[model samples]
Target: MLQMLHEKGLRAEHCYAAGIASIGAAFVSWMLSQRMESNGIARADRWGIFIGEWAPTFIALGNGLRTYEK
Candidate 1:
């Protein structure tokens, strides 16, 4: 997967940027869910959590890609 990502031109910087973006996205998702969902805060929390989880995966991928780059 790491090799494939590298081959596809996905650099560590791109993954790092995605991880940072995901954090912001989580906040936006939480806010949107809170306003739009019937379940309110609980739903918002879930939305926030789901998106927040992506950051770690992206960061890990970034680290892996960095190794590949070297």
Candidate 2:
């Protein structure tokens, strides 16, 4: 998908970077939740999962855009 976006002259790099960043954020959220002293661990997990969901869409959009360009 990234390759297709790159070929289509879209800034696939940024899309890829955003996906990576989202995953990082999700990981951090999960870690923080685990380290928390309160009962917010589940909240943190949910937040991480929610944020993690976005990565795939961004990737898909990038891929779709690339395919459309082609």
Candidate 3:
């Protein structure tokens, strides 16, 4: 999968950047949900946790791609 992604021109840097971006996005989503929803903190926490989950995947992909780059 990493090899295929590399072949498609996806690089480690891209994944690393995405990981960083996802973190920011998670925070933003949490804040937004907290502010906008009537459902309160639980919903906000869920939103935050859901988006936060993407960071590990991107970071892992970045690591894998870095290996392929070698």
Candidate 4:
């Protein structure tokens, strides 16, 4: 999968950027959920957590891609 991704032009920088973006997205999602939904803090927390979970995977992928880059 890493080989294929590299072949297709996937890069570490892209994953790093996405990971960073997801961090902000998590905050945005939480705020939006808090204001736009009537479900309260618990629901907003879940929304933020779900999006925040993506960052680790993206950062890990970036590290793996960095190996390919080297």
* Tens digits of per-residue lDDT for model 1, 38-64: 976987899999999999999999999
All candidates' TM-scores? Answer: 0.94, 0.67, 0.97, 0.97
**Which structure is stronger by TM-score: 1 or 3?**
3
Task: Put the candidates in lDDT order, highest first.
Answer: 3, 1, 4, 2
| Tens digits of lDDT, candidate 2, 3-67 | 65567677645666788888998898888877883776778788789989889977776666655
Q: Cα miss at 54, model 1 (Å)?
A: 0.3
- Model 4 CA deviation exceeding 4 Å by range: none
Q: Each model's number of backbone clashes? A: 0, 0, 0, 0
lDDT of 3 by residue, 1-69 (tens): 899999999999999999999999999999999999899899999999999999999999999999989
Off by over 4 Å in 1: none
Clashing pairs in 2: none
Q: Which candidate is the best by TM-score?
A: 3
Which TM-score value belongs to model 1? 0.94
Higher lDDT: candidate 2 or 4?
4
lDDT (C-alpha, whole model) for all candidates: 0.96, 0.75, 0.98, 0.95
Judging by lDDT against the true structure, name the best candidate: 3
Q: How far is candidate 3 from the true structure (C-alpha RMSD, Å)?
A: 0.5
lDDT of 3: 0.98
TM-score of candidate 3 against the unseen true structure: 0.97
Candidate 3: deviation at residue 63, Å?
A: 0.3
